[model samples]
Target: MQGRTLNFVTKSMVKTKRIPKQARAKARIAAILSATDALLRSSLPSNITTTAIAHTAKIPVGSVYQYFRDKNDILEQLYAEASKQVEELVLAEQSAVDPALGFDHINRTLLQCFWQTARSHPTFGALTRWANREHSFVEVTPGTDSSLARLIMRTFEITGINLPAARKEAVLRISVTVVSAVVDIAFEEDDADKAQTLIDELALLLSGYLA
Candidate 1:
């Protein structure tokens, strides 16, 4: 989940520089991206024309093309932004980890961060799942995977988990897999309770595993 090899989608990479402070090209990007999300769930790419996105956005067709070269290009940016959101969540928490806390606290906080993010910007969750099926959107940075893995592995050092190197590696792998899987399932569930249930169950499961 952290270090998955999701790659680039198209040739044109959109520079988000032109985004004005008030106009918020970033928010506009999000709106257009969300429109594609509706398309991803409802129809194939071919079925979703620029007109559909324009109508969905209540803007002109040219506006869609303004930010992106084409549908595929915007899709790539959407995926990148989605991934960026998750990575940003994880990294922000990881940066401020308390030295006194055990790995268990860290894991719980990490799960909570992801859960909160999913609850807030659920479109990113849907976009992430959709990106899995279609490699049409994979604009992730190269170093992202190893960095996330190392962040998870650092918990072992803080908690004084005295295992052989092999065992620690195994634990890190499991943690990464479980963390991402739970997030994915929370999105897939779509029901509000499913996320709470998943997080609570995960809390118990990881507590035992850490013990």
Candidate 2:
């Protein structure tokens, strides 16, 4: 995850294909994405085929190509969309944070939002798995300067703690790394109680670190 996210922070992502203009064409494209999402829930991205997506979408294979270059292209778009959804979730939750309540309250609120969003998204775990396996180099959008990062920076800065620019970046990077590691582990556990425990510990760990 470290190498992959670092690559995202450093490199450019491949541009996707042309957008559909007409309503009918747009519907076809939407169907393709929806089919891809459904298929992804059951199979790894590498194992999914363009033909399979075409069949699932009930569109001609050539029509799928009309909107996407191939299966991987479809996956890339889906991955981008998924990341955007998660980013929005983070931003919305961050906006509701009450700064006067102190770092611990702010920390727990943000972490809970992230965990709940991840759990609610049926494809979140699958997307992470696919990303780790196939396109490790592809930069997930918003990069390292995500809304969550900005929120964290702002929270710490308001406390009147003077951190150098370099130090600020390092702190955000380590915090993101630590939280993500624990969240990833929580996602894989079958036991709901254990998953909640992992997330609780993550909140405790991050709150202490930031405090």
Tens-place lDDT per residue, model 1, 87-174, is 6776787778896777778778876776776567645655556555553212322232454456666656666767786686677667
Lowest summed lDDT window (length 10), candidate 1: 2-11
Q: Write the per-residue lDDT of candidate 2 for residues 1-211, one digit (tens) a residue.
A: 2232311221233334767789999999999999999998888777889999999999998898887777877876676677567767777876666667777777787777777776777776676666555633223323346544565676676444456787777878776566655765676687889999998898898777766
Against the hidden reference, what TM-scores do the models get?
0.62, 0.78
Model 1: per-residue Cα lDDT at residue 211: 89
Task: Provide the RMSD of all predictions against the true structure, rounded to 1 decimal.
Answer: 6.2, 3.8
lDDT at 141, model 1: 22
lDDT score for residue 205 of model 1: 86
Which residue pairs collide, candidate 1? 3-145, 7-138
Highest TM-score: give the candidate number: 2
